[model samples]
Target chain A: MDFWSNFLINLVQGLTTTLQILVISIPLSIITGFILGFARVYGNKIIFYISTGISTTFRGLPLIVTLLILFFGLADLKIYLSPFWASILGFTLCGGSYISEYVKGAIQSIEQGQAEAARALGMNKLQEIIYIILPQTLIRALPGVSNEIIYMIQYSSLSFVIGVKEIFSVAKTFNSLYFRSIEIFTTVAFVYLLLIAIATLVFKIIENKLKIT
Target chain B: MISDTILNVVDLHKKYGDSIALDGVSFRVRKGETKVIIGPNGSGKTTLLKCLNLLVKPDKGRIWLGNIEITDPRININKIRRKIGFVFQDFNLFHHLTVLNNVMIGLVKVRKLKKHQAYKKAVDALSTVGLDNTLYHKYPAQLSGGQKQRVAIARALAMDPVIMLYDEPTSSLDPQFVNEVLQVIRKLAKNGVTSIIVTHQIDFALEIADEIIVMHKGRIIESGRPTELLSNPQNILTKKILIRNFRTLR
Candidate 1:
């Protein structure tokens, strides 16, 4: 096939698979991260320790190691997950930890006065966290969370390693058939750039809407 | 359950590290009466006001807000806090919320009022402090210092607390903005909200206080009617503050 025909065929397959994984993983990681972050800060001693331990452990381990362990090790226990599921599980484990750090930092940056004011108003602990602290925290966490999504766009390429046939894997197959390393890789870079640009624009609109200062 | 005292503090003591912030301080506020506390910067006046609502728990003391023992570990402090409104020095408005929401949050979250009911109360409270409907939607950052403080006052007032505590409510404002906040506070006291105010504004205290208490080194040195206390202060510290005030004003 000609270069244009080859590129177009690989692009469709690669981009679609990459987006499918990201579309589901991003929301799951964000929700999981928020709960973990809140638990790390507000939970009882046992819960706080457990949440902090999980985030710390995941953050320290390399993503590839986690994926290898999860994909292969699970089989020994009679649990079966496809390459796609393995990629998602690994990325979520890593992404959830990073997002939790962002959320925890955002919550900490809020002044002590906000909590005091909330309590003085007669809000119970749950109500204070839900109505007052969480709204402000999410607003503060937006820039960090946006950056995390951009990271997801880049890191989704890692899914190719597990034979998930994401964009990078498709690019690799296309390069093998055509023997065009420079051209194929350059196109992949631009595809990521395009995704980042779109992400940036979406985040900018959200940041403006949520800004308190 | 039926008590004329709006607040009572007995043998209140708090120490930070090696320093004593409040030492055996005691006072009582009757229903609908204003008690203005005056003192120098390190005099523990702020600590005393905070301990009333258990904002800063006293190391050793008993605080009674009506019939509930606020300092007791068994009591739900949140319920006690709602009945005793506190206006902070820095306004402490929720920066993320609009002025209306700032006033309404306590009503909705604490009082558990319906949104429309909370809305009406919020508007009434805001207008009570002279904030018009036009500024209701504006955020704290968009407001002037006086306006922000009024919103803070409105936030507390919307709860309809039986007692209000003011901790230098005008302390953070520009001189031009101070009078507006002071005026709103005076109106609350006049309209029969029991109050305990801590301020350096001696003239304003004399104008509004039903009783004036002078604090020095974590102790009440003099307590009496504003005129008598200011005119014939017995303690050297109170006399010094009074002399300084008169000299500056004259």
Candidate 2:
């Protein structure tokens, strides 16, 4: 096969893997964030402390360390995770921690009266959070969550370290084989840029639709 | 408990870091009666209202809503709250929701009404509060303060609560808007919706109150029919509060 055609086929294959990671990880991370954030804010003392600890520990570690630990370090304990699963788990923990920080702040910024009003109307704690609090928190946390998503796309390249052959990894392999360093890497960079641009536009549209006004 | 009494409070006491908010405050409201509570700030009128619904748990008190001892830890507070509608001074309308949805939420979520039924009830309650159809789809942020308070009232009213609690329902409104909210409350009062209102508006209180209870320093200083209390106040503090309201209004 010609160099450009061979490279394009491999790049497309790698792009699929990257999209898979994002499709699964984004929702997982968001769910993780809401649970941890809400637990820290409104949970009982024991739950609050535990959730706070989890968020703090994950956020403190670098994403690369989290991925490495999940993929390789856990093998010492005979806990096996595939490179793909390990990458997903690591991204979820790290990204979720940061998202939870935004979630926590957003939840706090809502007036106490909002919760009180829901309670007065006989909504249980869960109902209040689901129907009233979460909707408002999501809107307030959107800007920060959007930033995390953009970062997630960029950092997803790091998964190649764990042997998950995503976009950047495909380009790196092509570079070694053809020694076309500039061409291969620049194409990879543009792919990431395109993905982030699309993500940004999607989030912008959501933010506009959900604007309280 | 009296057969017709909807709410009964006995020896309610609350202290926020040694500043006594409600000191042995006690009161009762009969079915379909409007009992107006007048007091200065920090005098515990708001605190008393909160304790009735267990929003602010009393440091020491026993409250009976209908026949249930709501203050008891084993009892279901949510069930009790469903029967009692609370309107906050600031309106506290769910800002993200349209006026219609704001009223429909409690009906659907708490009352467990069907969507169509809840929507119908919400519309009825909104109309009862004198809100126009044009405002139904608008968010609370798009409405005037008076309109927001009316929506808040409709939100509570849709639950078909046995009693309504108003904590200065019009205090957050602009001067021009207060009368609209007051009119809604007056209409509800005339319709015989049992309520306990805490307000600085003594004139409105006198007009609608079956009985007026005066509070001072976290205690009920006096209680009687509005005319009787106004004509012959039993406490110097009551006279001063009534005088203050008159001066503020004038």
Q: For residues B1-250, could you state the per-residue lDDT of candidate 2 as single tens digits?
A: 7899998999999999979999998888899999999988878899999999989999998999888889899998999998999999988888789999999999888888999999999999999999999999999999999999999999999999999999999888899999999999999989999999999889999889999998889999899998888788889988887777767877
- What is the Å distance of residue B175 in model 1 from its true position? 1.2
Where in model 2 is the C-alpha error above 4 Å? B247-250
TM-score of 1: 0.95
Q: Please give, for residues A54-123, the per-residue lDDT of candidate 1 as tens digits.
A: 8998899888777877788897798888889988888787888889999999889988888888887777
lDDT of 1 by residue, B115-188 (tens): 99999999999999999889998889999999999999999999999999999999999999999999999999
For each candidate in turn, the interface RMSD (Å) is 1.4, 0.7
State the displacement of the C-alpha of residue B171, model 1, in Å, after optimal TM-score superposition.
1.0
lDDT of 2 at A100: 93
What docking grade does candidate 2 earn? high
Q: State fnat for each of the candidate structures.
A: 0.64, 0.83
Error of 1 at A171 (Å): 0.5
Writing each residue's lDDT as its tens digit, candidate 2 over A1-213 gives 999999999999999999999999988998899899999999999999999999999999989999999989998789999999999999999889989999999999999999999999999999999999999999999999999989999989999999998998999999999999999999999999999999999999999999978
